[model samples]
Every structure is written in structure tokens, then in C-alpha cells.
Target: MEHDQELNNNLRKVKEKFMLDLVDKLNRINRDGLEYGSSALNVCYMTSIVDKQILQCEEFLKDISRGYFIEDYEEDPTGYTNGSIEIQCLNATKTYTLKFTESYCGDMAQCYPSFKLSERHGVGEYEWNYFEDDYEEYEANFNKKYSAIYKDIEQKKKERRIQDIKIQMEMLSQELTALES
Candidate 1:
């Protein structure tokens, strides 16, 4: 019984660590832009790498949960629950903001494992699906073309060439942001 308790504690620690790492990676990607402002292939590779790490963590957690290595605990406001676990989990997942639900002081203790696990797996698939064979060839072509343009500009050393490129890129970025807004 003690061993089981220790294993459950370890699994909880691992899950918490993995969640923290995932958030950090997400923030880094958001700050760096979706495309890396460098190369499509480079961006694809980086995303794929992050995706694999998250996937491995997710799978490990799922296995642990399957083995009943973690226990679910929640605070009952009135000391008696009125809703099914499934309903509570679904509401928690859908109604809570990521900042609130996934925060260090979050209410994830009440969250349903099934919803959280499914969302994690879906995100991992979305991240890695960008690197499949068909998409890889497309990205390679994009990288080759854009990189060649950049290389040509460097070889010529035209006056204010890099600055002009930067300005254009900035304008395009602004336009994209405006469109999204």
C-alpha cells in the first residue's frame, strides 16, 4: 500500500512537471512566431521535436493513469456532489480559461482526466502532422525558394538591402496581425 501511494505521488509530480514544460514551450513558440521568421523546414523540425516530447509525456501519463497510479480528488462546496463526474469534467474543460485552469494555483484537481488526456493527444497530433511526407516536400520547396532569395541578397550586398527586407517583413507582419484582429 505504501508503494502504491509512493508511485501515485511520483506520477502526480511527473504530470505537474510535464504540464509546466508544455506551457513554457507554448510561450516560447508564441514569442518566436509560428514560422520562426527563418525557414519553413526549420520551423517544421522544431515543432516536430516539441511535439514528440509532449507526446511521450502524454503517453507516459496515460499509462500511469491506466495502471491506477493516480487518485482524483476534489473539494465539494456543500460537502455532497450533485453532478456526475463526466459532467463536471466536461464543464471544467470547456468553461475554464487556460490561464485559470492550467495555472499553478489552478483548479485542475477537479478536472476530468479523460478530457485533459484527449486534448493533449489532439494537440500533439496537430503539431506533428505538419511534418508528414506530403507536407515535408512542400516545406522543403518553400525553404529552398526563400533561402535562395535571402542568399542572393547577401551575395549582392546591395545598399540598405537587409534593412529594406526587414522593413518589408515588418509591414507584412503588421498586415497579418491586422487581418487576424
Candidate 2:
């Protein structure tokens, strides 16, 4: 019984650590992109990666809730939730595939998740093209393509700041009005 309690405590600590790491990874992906070759691929990979991690964590938590002792348990390292990540873009005119190796799950325990581009079609003819490992060029093009998104995000942030200031002003005005009364 005491051993079980100790195990549960240890599992809780591990889960907390994993959750923190997951959040950090997500923030990094959101800020810097997925570190994948292209923006499209980055978006696809990031979503899939986050989904997989969430599912895996949920499953582990479920097992723990059920009092199942999970030994050597770690986050799924399969590069994808499943075997491969398939993305269709350009009005379904282009398809891309990123496949994970059999060793990928094991590798995940040791390093960050990664995938290899297994297949691609209709490159250069669509909004999302296969990067062919040209990461530097891909990053440049991605930034250029998504500059508007960054601008819009900044605009929204500024608007929120303005709204907050207005709220503060109103509150102060009410306080002054009360004092004058």
C-alpha cells in the first residue's frame, strides 16, 4: 500500500513535468514555427504533434487513475500520432506524407520528435510546397507568407492594451466622480 502511494506520487510528478514540457514545446512552436521545412508543414506537424501528446498524456493519466502501474512510460516518440502524417493542400490538389521510422517512438524518449518526408506531389504549383530539406529558404518564404498573421496578432494585442487602458480610465473617473459627489 505504501509502495503504491509512493508510485502514485512519482507518477504525479512525472505527469506535471510532462505537462510543463508540453506547454513549453507548444509555445515554442507557436512563436518560432515547428522547425519543419515549410509553414504548411510546420502547421500540420505542430497540430499533429500536440494532438498526439495530448492523447498520449490522457491515456497515461487514465491508466494511472485506474491504478495501473505503468513502468518505463514516456511520451510517444513516434513523430506522429500514428505511423505517418498526411496533409492535403492547394484545394486538395497536392498531397504530402511524413513517415516515422519504427525506432522513432524509442527515439522520442531520448530526443525531440522528428519525421522524414516520405512522399510529395505537385510541388511549386500550390500555396504549400514540399521543402526538400531547404530549411533556410523555406523559413524565409514562410515568414514572408505569414507576415500578415504576425501583423494581425500584434494589432489585436495593441487593441487589447487600448481596451484595458480605457477600462482603467473609466474606473478612475468613477472614483473621482464619487469623491466630487
Candidate 3:
């Protein structure tokens, strides 16, 4: 009987300790919220709401993204697409076509000129220089008649990958159109 009483007392102490720790954690969170002038709580609440809104936005975007296209035409001096954009995103690469114009009209004008993308477990900063020329022949004309075949292949691959991304961006833009409609 004495042993049973001792065990019960120990359990009661453990429970009290656990409750104390839980209360301390709650107090800390409350204090942090107050110390930051409720900004912390406001951010948390806003982000939670934003999370849902982002999903709705994503759905609308996905629908239109599937239909985006880039027309092939000579750009004027002022910089304009005069075409559509199309793209697809795969495991490690993407395919796309984008056109730029001086006017910020609508879908055709919404294309991003330059951007960067990187992976945590892989290479860093895969990006596009919108103004950079797709000149494999120029790069090959370096040094002797033809410096290296490997460089030529690599440059071609990089150019193709950029095109893929452009396609994906166009799709995303189409999806974004859903929000407006």
C-alpha cells in the first residue's frame, strides 16, 4: 500500500512539471506577440489566410498556363513580342518561348525579361540573360578555327533549356488570366 502511494505521488509531480513547462511555452509565445506590437500574430494570421488564397490563385493560373503561346515574329526596336509564349516544366529542365514588347498591355506584355532559378540539392542559379545572344557559332569561332566541340554542344543544351523555361512561364501567365476572368 505504501509503494502504491509513493508511485501515485511521483506521477502527480510529473504531471505538475509537464503542465508548468506547457504554460511557460504559452507564456513565451504570448510575450513575443506582445513585444513585437502584435505584428508577429498579425503576420501569422495573414500568412495562414494567404496560404489559402495562393491555392485559389494557383488553380486559376494553372488553367490558363496550359494555353499560353508565343508567336514567332521580328521584334521592333522598341521591344515587343508580336507573338505568344508557350512552355513546359520537366524534372530538371523546362521548354518555352517568350516575346517581349515595350508596352505593358496584357498577356503578351507580361513576360519577364530576366530571372534566376536554383536547386537546393543541385546546381546554383540557373538563369537567363534576356539580352544575351544565342550565338553558338560565335562562341565556336574562338581561338583556332574551332576551339572545341564540347563547348558547342553545351551551349546548345543551355539554349534549349532556356526555351523550355520560357514555355513554362507562358503557361503560368495563362493560368493567371483566370483571376481576371
Candidate 4:
């Protein structure tokens, strides 16, 4: 029993750290407009819903069934509960927003939660079924793309560090010559 508790505590700590890192990355992306790239964003979005607890709220189900979802945030008398995020995508020429909505089961959102890229400005709504093989392929492809992007970023950082070190060495050499004179 003691061993199980220790393991759970460690797992919880790791989960907390991961969440912090994810939130930081999301914040950076929001501020800079996909500087980390869309593949990374997509992977992060999908990974968040892994093994989610489903709560079927009859209230939300009605709106969901009718094909209408809460697109924007609103403050009810009780509180503010908007389970939607507006993601901005910046390309070479233009910037646009994509809205992602969470599908939940229960009195509110995020009960047994899943996400969908429900709407895109200038483009229409989107639907992705999990049962489809195409969906699986799409997920795999997204993961692959994200992995590649991550590796490229790491490689570029290493190259940049090397360049910085060389510049520092040059500066140090110049400083030494001036001191000797």
C-alpha cells in the first residue's frame, strides 16, 4: 500500500510538470501565432483528450444533437464556463482563427471530454469521426509531423548555440589583445 501511494505521488508530480510545460507552449503559440508550428499544436490538442472521463450532460447533448455548439465564451449568472479555444494560425501571407470545441457528457462541458475543430473562419465547419481508419492515419501523420518538427527545432538550437560560442570566442580574443596592448 505504501509503495502504491509513492508511485501515485510520483505520477501526479510528473503529470503536473507536463501540464505546466503544455500550458507554457500554448501561451507562446497564442502570443506568437503558431511559432511552434501547427503540427505541434495539433499533437498537443489531441494528446490532451487522451483517456478522458465522459460525463453525458443532457443539457449539452441537446445543443450538440442540433448541430449548434457554444462558439464563444459567455458568462452565465452562475459562472463563466466556456469550453472553447480560438486558435490563431499565421501563414506567410495571412492570419486566421480556428475554433475548437469540447464535446462533453454531464451538466457542463469537459465531462468525458473530446475536441473537434468545429469551425474555421472563411472556411466551414469540420467533422472528424474516431472510428474511421482515415482518422487513425491522420493522427499518426500528425504525430510524425510533430516529431519531425521537434527534432528540427532541437537541431537548429544546437547550431545556434555553436554560432554563439564562436562569437563569444572572437570577442574574448579581441578583449585579450586590447588588454595586452
> How many clashes (backbone N, Cα, C below 3 Å) per candidate?
0, 0, 25, 10
Q: Write one digit per residue (lDDT tens) for candidate 3, span 28-122.
A: 44344444443111112112112212222232233323332222222234523222123232322333332222222245543322211112232
The better candidate by lDDT, 3 or 4, is: 4
Candidate 4 yields a Cα-based lDDT of 0.40
Q: Model 2, clash count?
A: 0
lDDT of each: 0.37, 0.40, 0.33, 0.40
Order of candidate numbers by TM-score, starting with the best: 4, 1, 2, 3
Candidate 4 wrong stretches, greater than 4 Å: 1-85, 88-145
Candidate 4: minimum summed lDDT over ten consecutive residues — where?
51-60
Better of 1 and 3 by TM-score: 1
Instruction: Give the per-residue lDDT of model 1 (tens digit) for 29-147.
Output: 33333223421112223322333334344444544343321112222356232101111122123211111111111353532111122323332222223324544675575356445
Which candidate model has the greater TM-score, 3 or 4?
Answer: 4
Winner by TM-score between candidate 4 and candidate 1? 4
Q: For model 2, how does the per-residue alpha-carbon lDDT over 35-86 read when each residue is reduced to its tens digit?
A: 3321222333332233233333333443334332211211236534324344
TM-score: model 1 vs. ground truth: 0.25
What RMSD does each model have against the real structure?
18.4, 21.0, 28.3, 17.3
